[model samples]
Target: MRLALAQLEIESAAVEDNRERAEAAVAEAADRGADLVALPEIFNVGYFAFDAYQRAAEPVEGPTLSRIADAAREHGIGVLAGSIVEDLAETESVETPADEGLANTSVLFDRDGRRLAVYRKHHLFGYESAEARMLVPGESLGVAEFEGATVGMTTCYDLRFPELYRDIAAEGADLILVPSAWPYPRVEHWQLLPRARAVENQLFVAAINGSGEFDDAELLGRSTVYDPWGTTLAGTGDDPDLVVTDVDLDRVAAVREEFPAWRDRRL
Candidate 1:
């Protein structure tokens, strides 16, 4: 399937401007005849824009996701919407809760406007700041069939965890999609981690990240796609641009057949 990765710049807390940018990028991806279009993590509201979550967070059926579904249906292309703040009303409190705070959520939609799955970020980054304090970590990773391939879904922080990828791989996922808002200094990790996961798991990895600086942290937008052989098929350099690549799903089968590393694993 032909995937268009929108590696674009996002201004922290500016939802309107970011939405315009994302819309344009999706349109551009459609123009290129891409079967699936993916965006970076929290492109609507910048990742460092922590304060915006309360205001920017909306339900999965709300504007942000609704717009994406419409776009996917309109253009006849599947969409891998990057992370957004999802308000969970299902788990609301009586005293102070209209809804439980925020979840770093990635929503996928098929060309027919069907909600494929919702994968919230299971690993919330709390090593530095207090992401766990505000954001609710997702319960599980999600896999869905889209664009003729079984795609495993993960968010930014989840990329650092190899077990998550391995679990998905064991579930027969051929391609992995990671929507991230990785910051600078860790730029190398953002680039290297995904490739390493691809190599180890023997699956195609498609990582999408946001560009531009936000607050005190700058997002190093080096969105990348790696083949099953760990080849860098496409990569960007901390800039706002789209990386388009055609990924042949059959390669996953071919590589696993030749190497047979996954099958030989004892543990």
Candidate 2:
């Protein structure tokens, strides 16, 4: 499968501009022959825009994801609408983690514009940030079958927890997509975690981050895709880019059979 990771240039509280760029990227990715394209976390309302979270919040099937689904159908490519600030109170289509608060949520759309999965961020960032206190945590894992492969979804801070990836791997997931809004000074952690998860889980892990700066933070955009063997198939520097690469779905099973590391897990 050909996957595209769009490292978008996000502006704090600039909902219209951000959504426009994201849709353009989707069209470009599809034109580039990508079967699926994934966006970064909170691509509409920048991650560091804490004050704007409540104002920019929308339901799971709000305008943001609705436009994304339309773009996917128009381009005839699957899309992971990276994530949006979800107004759980207004969200009635899906089971929300909370009823009165906001949550970091992502939605996946098929080529035909059908909703496939909804993944609220399980691990909310708490270190020097307002994320944990501002949003409700997701209770369920997001996994779905798409294009002959089982795909799993996780958000930025979730990369620090390997147990989540292990659980998804145990669910027979072939590829994991991480929609992140990682910032500077943690570049090493951003680089290390995804590769480790891919190698250990024997599956593809694509870490998609955003670009541009906020008032108190700057998103370090080194979007990347790692194969089952922990090899970097395609990656970009800390800038706005669309990283695309072909991944063999069969490689997941083949590598697991050859390495047998995952099979040896006793605990």
For residues 1-267, could you state the per-residue lDDT of candidate 1 as single tens digits? 888899978998889898888888888998998899899888898888888888888788888877888888888889898878888863232122224667888888899778888888888988765677888777766899876689999988888889999999988899999988888798678778899999999999999988888667888888899999889998888889989999999999899999999989888
Over the stretch 1-267, how does candidate 2's per-residue lDDT look in tens digits?
A: 999999999999999999999999999999999999999999999999999999899998799999999999999999999899999999988987776899999999999989999999999899999999999999899999898889999999999899999999999999999999999989999999999999999999999999999888899999999999999999999989999999899999899899999899999
Q: Please estimate how well model 1 matches the true structure, expressed as its whole-model Cα lDDT.
A: 0.85
Task: Tell me the deviation in Å of residue 260 in model 2.
Answer: 0.4
Off by over 4 Å in 1: 90-99
RMSD per model, one decimal = 3.0, 0.7
TM-score of each: 0.95, 0.99
Q: Distance (Å) between predicted and true CA of 147, model 2?
A: 1.4
| Candidate 1 displacement at residue 166 in angstroms | 0.6
